[model samples]
Target: MTMILGFPLAPIRGVIKLGELLQEQVERELRDPAAVRRRLEEIEQARAAGRISAEEEAEAVNRVLRGMQT
Candidate 1:
């Protein structure tokens, strides 16, 4: 019966749905201006603290800006 076949796939379906939800949340946050600003600030702080190099900071900032565009 279909139930027998579907039972094994139920967990897979749930995992897929969870992944979709997480993706949606990430996209929503990326579109948030404040969230983007905070990320940029974090990158700057890291650079100032020497936790990241200037090149790394630039790359991180570019990535955050690109995420905003998307």
Candidate 2:
């Protein structure tokens, strides 16, 4: 029966649904102005601390900016 076949797939379905929810949350955060500003600030702090090179800082900044566009 359909129910019998679906029973075995319930866990897989649940996992997929969870993944989708997580992805949505991440995308929502990426588009948030406050979240983007915080991320940029973190990158700047890392650069100031010499934890990342200038090029690396530029790349990280670009990546964060690009994420906001999407």
Best candidate (score: TM-score): 2
Error of 2 at 33 (Å): 0.9
For this target, which candidate reaches the highest lDDT against the unseen true structure? 2
Q: Evaluate model 2: give its TM-score.
A: 0.84
- TM-score of every candidate: 0.74, 0.84
After TM-score superposition, the amount by which residue 30's alpha carbon in candidate 1 deviates from its true location, in angstroms, is 1.8
C-alpha positional error of residue 27 in candidate 1 after TM-score superposition, expressed in Å: 1.2
Clashing pairs in model 2? none
- For model 1, give the 10-residue run with minimal summed lDDT: 61-70
Go through the candidates in order and give each one's C-alpha lDDT.
0.95, 0.97
Task: Please report how far candidate 1 places residue 24 from its true position, in Å.
Answer: 0.5
Q: List model 1 lDDT by residue over 1-70, tens digit each.
A: 9999899999999999999999999999998999998999999999999999989999999999999888
